[model samples]
Target: MLKRYKKYSFLFQELVHRDFTKKYKRTALGIGWSVLSPLLQLLVMKIMLTKFFATGIEHYTTFLFAGNIVFNYYNESTSSGMTALAENSAIISKVNVPKYMFVFSKNISSLISFLLTVVVFFVLAALDGIEFTWKITMLIFPIVCLVLFNIGLGLVLSACYTFFRDLQYLYSIFTFLLMYMSAVFYDISAYSDFAQKLFLLNPIYLFIRYFRKIVMEQTIPTIWFHLLMILDVCIVMIGGFYMYKKYNHDFLYYF
Candidate 1:
């Protein structure tokens, strides 16, 4: 797969560049929106929810930042990637390039935005009096997992969207529900033990919890948590690759 990708490395780079540029084109703030948008969201959530949900929570702003950043990345990556094939139908129908490259390029563009937002997250954490600790470096683990997970998920969504246009509408509603379930602003501990455990079933919640553990609590997550993250990525990637392999040719017909 690496060799196949490398064979068209230039094309991949161009796709990534084009997508990134197109995202910010004619925008006043341009890339600054990546940093400002999440911070603005954090401020709004903090103001509205602090009295109700943030009780007993230390560094609540930082905690919300951790969750929001991760969730937003997944949401943006998957949403954009879902349209990769259909959006690029003109090019795909003409060129002999790998279809997955378009999906990957969309993901890469989202990732660049996510990374820009991380800088704001850390700065906010520092301002909130959260000390910088060695454990903070451990954020990379969950981030790497989320990136792979998003790529895998993007592939699946793009493939599915090619066939069933209704998925686009359904997924928007699902993402909204997912945002609330992810506990981005609320404290999951407010729920009963059984309910808390149930939230773990959400991969987005798991990734957010993992980030909070390292960023907010300054501790490493359990080995089982790490394993589960890897397992989730593998399951999605396997399923996504299978779909792409089976339906790559079929995508053109639908397009």
Candidate 2:
């Protein structure tokens, strides 16, 4: 498995480049559009929410940036991952490469886009006068954990999608709900105790909230937060790998 992962690792970078290039090849603006989408969303949300959210939390724009960056990548990967195997049917059938490669490639593509947007967010945060600290260095750990979590998620979801076409529809609806539940636009503390506990149980929420604490508040999350995230990553990656190993051969038949 390690050899297989390394063998096609080069393809990961190439696939990511292909996806990024094709997205803006003919456009006058080119890659600027990738920077534009998230920036525009941030502007619209800032305007629209000012009237309602009003006073703002401590470093609220930074808070939203943290949540938006991570959540957007998760949304893109899992949603596209639903068809990761099925969409690559012709290549998978003709080649002997690992089935997980197709799914992993889609995620690497999204990760490239996400990194581009992160630059925009960093610049905007500086312009908005949000403070940057050495604490910003802490972002590295959470990001690595988030990537591992997403890879596991994409692998498992891609596998299930092979067996259940309905998973495509289900994944769409779930992403919509997951976005709101992630507390992207509001503080989780606004919810009742039971609701907050439920949110804490959600590993995605944990990841987003941890980022928010580091970037927005310039502080680490509580000890339990790190503990929970570590546990969640372990379970998801292990379970996802097992499922992928067991049924990956079936993916070709579905495609």
Best by TM-score: 1
Residue 245, model 1: Cα distance from true site in angstroms? 0.6
- Per-residue lDDT of candidate 2, residues 1-255 (tens digit): 788778887876676677668768999998887788887887788788756653647667767777777888888877776577888788889988887777777877777788888788788778767777998887777778877788888888888888888988888898889888888777867678998999988888888887777666779877788888888888878988899888867777777
Query: How many angstroms is residue 121 displaced in model 2 relative to the true structure, after the best TM-score fit?
Result: 1.5
**Best model per lDDT:** 1
Q: How do all models score by TM-score? A: 0.98, 0.91
Residue 131 lDDT (model 1): 81
lDDT of 1 by residue, 1-255 (tens): 899999999999999999999988999998888888888988898899899988889998988888899999999999999999999999999999999999999999999999999888888888999887898888898889999999999999999999999999999999999999999987877789999989988999999999888878888989988898899999999999999999988988998
Error of 1 at 180 (Å): 0.8
